[model samples]
Target: MSRFEEELKRDKFVCSECSRCKKIVWPPSNYCNKCLNETTWREISRKGKLVEYSYNKGECFGIVEFESQIRIVGTVKGSERPDVGQIMNLEKCDYDGDEIFIFSSTVQRNGSQNS
Candidate 1:
């Protein structure tokens, strides 16, 4: 398994924090792209918001942003259109013996009012 994928399966959502600038790097890497400095792994929340999305040929993909501004492009699992700021949950998915990450919409607040 790739390092990032392996880490995701073990650690849930993670980001590489640059020791210098403290920039959160998504798609975790060994080195920080911003400062070329060594990065330390930081665990981020599994739930985030869907910022953008697209669907084609029954395939869905979108960008999700976590609490720390950690964003990643992942396959969205549901049919609902992704709206900006829509809450989503990221989780590990097993496919073809490989672990993949996917996002799904979380339950929204029911606005039903008692009459």
Candidate 2:
């Protein structure tokens, strides 16, 4: 399995960063997409901003942007309605043939309610 998938199986969110250019490589690669330099794996922050969301069959799903760049789609978990630009916290992550990410609403750093 790829390193990314392996880490996901362990519930650790990680991505590649360019060793030379200090750039975060999305889609996690061994080499940087920009400079083609070697990449190092690094854990990602759990908090992110909700970019968009939708409900399918009463289940909430959203696209969250992390570190201002890494965007991922995941299931939104919580009873409260989620809003765009709300802070989201990664609640769970796993891999079972397919990647799985679960997130929930969170308060902003300024102590403001997000959801």
Candidate 3:
């Protein structure tokens, strides 16, 4: 398995860091977006909040922001409807034979939209 795939399967989520600037590059890149230096893999929080989202039919996708730094874009699924600033947890999911990533939110736990 490729390093990216292996990291996803083992750690759930990851972001790359620029060797020189030490800043994280989301969506995993070959090099830093700012400094153009080589990047290394780093594990991130599995939990975060939905900063923005939209869905077509039942499939949902959005940008989730971590507590401190970094944000990632990916699919999400949950019992209650998704909305901005809702807490969610990232997880590995399956789409046909491919390994995909998704988020399961616990928004209702905070006392809103229990559906």
Ranking by lDDT: 2, 1, 3
Between prediction 2 and prediction 3, which has the larger TM-score?
A: 2
Question: Which candidate number would show the highest lDDT if scored against the true structure?
Answer: 2
Per-residue error (Å), model 2, residue 70: 0.7
Model 1 local distance difference test score: 0.74
lDDT digits (tens) for residues 15-111 of candidate 1: 6788888887765777888889999877777888888888878989988888746777779987667777877888654334554668887765487
Q: Model 1: residues >4 Å from true position, as ranges?
A: 93-99, 108-115
lDDT of 1 at 26: 62
Backbone clashes for every candidate come to 0, 0, 0
Write model 3 residue lDDT over 1-115, tens digit each, in one string: 6556666666456678888998788656879999999999877778887898888777788888874567767788765568788777886633333547688876556677644
Query: Pairing residues by index, what is the TM-score of model 1?
Result: 0.71
- Best-performing candidate as measured by TM-score: 2
List where candidate 2 sits over 4 angstroms from the true fold. Answer: 108-115
- Candidate order by TM-score, decreasing, is 2, 1, 3
For residue 46, model 1's alpha carbon misses the true position, in angstroms, by 1.1
- Lowest lDDT 10-residue stretch of candidate 2: 106-115
